[model samples]
Target: MKIHLSYGKDGLDVEIPERNLAGVLSFGASTPLAHPEEAIARSLQEPIGSLPLGELATKAKSACIVVCDITRPVPNKQLLPPMLRTLEESGIARNKITILVATGLHRPSTAAELDLILGQSMVSKYRVVDHHASVPGEQSLLGETKRKTPVYIDKRYLEAELKITVGFIEPHLMAGFSGGRKMVAIGCAGEETIKTLHSPRVLDDERCREGSIDENPLHDELMEISRMAGHDFVLDVSLDANRNITGVYAGHPQEAHAVGVEAVRRSVRATLKEPADIVVTTSAGFPLDLTYYQSIKGMTAALPVLKKGGMLILAAECSEGLGSERFTAMATRFGTATEFDEWIHQHPVDIDQWQLQECLKAVRQGEVVVVASGIRPEHRDKLFVRTAASVEEAVAQGLQKFGSQTTIAVIPKGPYTLVEVSRTSA
Candidate 1:
């Protein structure tokens, strides 16, 4: 059987023998929108739970539109033009509108990346700036949540008379799902605010897992922060496996995001009859798999369908290497996975530590075999995982460890496809 997995830009297809396959887990197929631009315009015209964006823009002196950074697959190019036009048509001058890249704790997008993200026309025409989380003085402190998560958002985003956020809706490892409030709470938050949100205490909560919302404390707190940050409006899209926009949600951040979440839930949720002895997955490729830190999402997503002692074969290009210097430093500070866990339990204050801890949790589940061209031989040992030159070699290693009769499950879109073992099977 030939299984095609999402890899950098173009995708990767590997041939696996049918005899060893258990089942290929993937999201339900959804037809891509025939007219995404029209859909986006229509959605903005009749937004949920509020007046149309044009009407709202009329009252504004200035506007700040927050967009996802390079790490996300948000269709900024398609979404931004219509939004900018809406604001402009309402008499808001182009200079009064600023586009803020919600980098969170991630690095700033470069000039070429900015052009790719927002199109050269938009980038050159509009005043686009990257959020600097490290600069606390530049942020406005918007009180605390019930969980006492200090919400310090970018002053530009907070000070805007008209605040709008543009993002994609998808299952997230920590926030249940991404988009909406997340764009303000975490995306535009300062470094300390981000640390508080991703702290071990919050991340350890049971409800913090994927596809959960109603009772998710993390999600609830983020919403609280969003309210405090005064997130006026949001435009979120749901995409199919091929990155085509399938649905668009606009208007009130909470209301519109909920709609987008439901749409995404239908596309990505999958159920497995039983845990697999070996699970093969990818990090959704290209922009998302650019770094190992971001690629950890694939490992966490596989946990629900992975046997206690199963082997996880992860394929991520990671062309950007470790991605986070802090995360790599944390990994190097500990010798073993257990030590890493212990350290996190004691000192969970650092940025990106939570991700490393998640990586350690996956390590405790079983052995992790990684296949990536960018990872060096020396770095493999430091990452606490076995390295392979290709997915075929990793699968061969898994077969050797688990024996020929081992059940194998493949997740082609990785974190994009959420798999949960059926309760009956569990």
Candidate 2:
């Protein structure tokens, strides 16, 4: 079997294993990404036509708040050109438009980082500011949820006459899929409101154990919050392995986001359904494991498809594992979910963060586990059966222990595991 690789926009091709995967199964054969820019442009064109960003901005807009996806690698750099051009044509002047980095509790990106995501030219002209979640006064508490989660948000966003959200569509740790309403929900939402959703109780773990983004309650709530927030229009993007826009969905939040989901599902989802005894995989790449607060998706993908007591093999490069100090502190302060929640019952903070501690409890038992990543060996020992250097090695170890009769499932990226959930269910 031969796997092909190409660099700098040529295309990627992987020779399918000729040997009958008869009992063996591999889902996504590396295929060429043909006319990527054109594909993205076409998807975007439809929504651009509908919203007519230029026309709307030219009309009654006082101040425009352009909230950008400031998370890790997805800085909206590539899409910013055309999007800015549209805004300019639509009549919103550069000065009146304020660029917001919608980082909801994550550390704010620095000036150089912002320039990298939004290019030097654009960053120079537009007055941009990073959203501060820990700080007070700048952002206002819109309200609290039934669960008593507070919504800390960028006050400027609500005040703006026209609001434009830009982000890339990908798998999210909490949300089944990312983008569109996701921007308003987790991206720009306040800590309390987000906690109401992110907390283990509200998380859609068991609900979509074998379900897709469509059926997930987490995504459902995002849609609700986004609608109430009136995000107006969104430019949601989907990228290939190299972070190129393989698909772009633009328009009102609900309308075009589905396109992003399908495009990513094609390239990123697991192919086979039969339970695998030895599964070898990676984190599905970056942004998924940007930090542990964000790393759960990869685990979600492999968990459901494994047999009743099958072994799971994971290869994740969590170079920056557990990215948040608060997140790490929360994890260590409590021994169990019950204790964790009890702690939350008393102490008051911006967001109700105890829910994530609860979400962590679901994986304590079941089948055997194996992991090889940048995370500490102690952590691996605590979570998995073993850890190895490579996928082939992991598989070999698995076969030695579980026997060759076992199946194998591989996911290059864990974040997009939702695709496999539905396939496994089917």
Candidate 3:
């Protein structure tokens, strides 16, 4: 197996045994392939002249903000500067513009972190505000959909004459990809709207497999409801394992997303056969590289394919503890997803019940779970799953259970965890 890495603009490949689960691991879009600065340059190189929204901004009479999703590793370097330049060229002054960090229910990015993400120039030039969806009451809805569902938008976004959303597209667990309707779900709306959009009416239905973009339940509705809201323009990019922009689409939300979706279909998704006896996976390295919360998406992608009581070996280096405070709080508070579902039904404040449930479910299904992570020994020992210090140890443990009958599924760097199905002739 050959594993490729990028330090700067250069690519370095490391080869390991095809059967060696120890060294050969393939990561997703979490890593950076194109240099961030260069990716930014490329996005800037795009001719924004054809876009209706860009044209609208060009002739705008007042100011509008460029609200870029800073969640995960959005190509912010490629996202902001050119947008500002374009908006500025359109007549909106840099000072009049604002950048909102759509934190939604996630932890807010610090000023230093924001500076690191948006670059010092934009940080110094314009107001960079973090959208606090923590307080649901503070948010406002733009209008009601035909279904009578209110299209909640960030109050600040409504403040501007034109609102622009920018984000990176990747295989997402709930909403298919990140960019399409994510802005409406997490960026514009309050928690109530978020929950409403994602609640039982949205979840508790037939779910699409993690890598199944077209079939995913949440992804289906998000697209419908987002179009209801007047999302002016959208810019989304499909990135490779190294966070390199493999594709970029900018236009009316659906059109742009369709273009991006088509590209992602060719490049990202993989299919697998079901019912593996032993599954080994890494924490979808990079953004999910260092955190337990972010890494859980890999497990969600991997789990449904496992047979009953099948062992799942998770290799996540959760060095940053849990990524978000709320993620940690919910993971520990509820014993199962059903319990969280019931709890959310009663509470009615949080946005992601399905997320809470999956974590708890994963925790409770410890009989089938094994963790070979960078977490401390004491912590690993205490976690619900059986813990191994290294990959060889994890695989060896699985071998003990099945001897030769065990079928091993290896997903190195495991977001969009792929399951392989093959009818090999005996």
Candidate 4:
């Protein structure tokens, strides 16, 4: 059987033996809006649980719009224009309106990348700034949550008379779902705040996994942080597997995000009768698969459909190699996931340790093999997990390890498409 997997800019096709194939899991195909930009404009005018964006903008002098960095495939070019136009037309000065890239703890987006993120036309016209989590002076303390998680948001966002965030709704490994509160709580949070949110205390909770919302502690914490930061309005969209806007939600943060999440849950959830003995997954390509740190999401997202001791293979471009300096150092330092977990428990949460922490979850569950061509030769062996040269080679190794009886499942879209075992079949 020939299966095409989402990898890098151009996808990859590999031949999987028909006898071993369980199924290719993917999100339901959603039709793209016939007039997406017009749909976005209408969503702003007729929003849920709040006044229209234009009306809201009229009241505030300065507005701050937070957006996800390059890792997420948010249609920023489409989402930004209509909203920015509304703010400017409603009396907010062009200079007073700041588009803050919520980078979290990731590296700042370069000038060239900014052009790619928000088109050169928008970049030159608007006040665009990347949130620097490590810079202390850039953040302002917003007090603490009920869980005592410190809330430190970007000063530019907190100081703004009107706070807004634009993101797409998708299943998130830690926050239950991405978009809404996340664009501010984590994206615009300071380093200390980012560390606490990613620390084991929050993530170790069983409810923190994907597709969980109501009971997710991390989700609740993020909402609290967003509230303290005065998250006024949100404009979030739901995208199909092809990255086309399927649904546009604009209004009060929690209310509109809930609407978008419901739509996404219906579209992205996929299921199998039983756990697969071997699973093949990807980091959903390009911007997401650019680094190994981001690639870990592919592994964790497939865990629900994979047998506890199954051989799991991940294919990521990792064009930038291992990741940030701190993540690369931590990844190479510990020889095994067990050792790494032990050390992290005893020490303070270091920068970029959270990605490795999530990686440890996958490592503890089963054997993992990473197929990434961009990694340097020396760095391959140093990773906590094994590395393979290609997806075909990784599959061959898995078949050898798990034998002919082993069931193989493939998740071509990886983390973007949520997979789970059917309760009745189990």
lDDT of 4: 0.91
lDDT tens readout by residue for model 3, 165-231 = 7776666666656675777656666766666665655554446445456667666656666665556
User: lDDT of all the models against the reference?
Assistant: 0.87, 0.57, 0.59, 0.91
Worst 10 residues of 3 by lDDT: 5-14
- Candidate of highest lDDT: 4
Clashes of 4: 0
Which candidate do you rate higher for TM-score, 1 or 2? 1
lDDT by residue (tens digit), candidate 4, 144-263: 999988888899998899999999999999888899999999999999998999998877888999888988999999988888889889999999888999999999999999999999
- Candidate 3 off by > 4 Å: 1-53, 62-71, 136-138, 143-150, 213-217, 273-275, 323-326, 334-353, 360-386, 416-426
Better of 1 and 3 by TM-score: 1
Question: In model 1, which regions exceed 4 Å deviation?
Answer: none
User: What lDDT score goes with residue 171 in model 2?
Assistant: 59
Clash pairs, model 1 backbone: none
Each candidate's TM vs. the true structure?
A: 0.97, 0.78, 0.80, 0.98
Question: Candidate 1, residues 26-123: lDDT per residue as tens digits?
Answer: 98988899999999999999999879999999999899999988888889888988899999999899999999999999988899889788888888
lDDT of 2 at 317: 53
Q: Compared with the true structure, what per-residue lDDT tens digits does model 2 show for residues 183-288?
A: 6666676655665676555653555342357667777777766666667667777665556555567777677777667776665665454555544444455544
Model 2 alpha-carbon drift over 4 Å, by segment: 1-49, 62-75, 144-150, 208-215, 262-269, 332-373, 376-397, 417-426
Order the candidates by lDDT, highest first — what do you get? 4, 1, 3, 2
Better of 2 and 4 by TM-score: 4
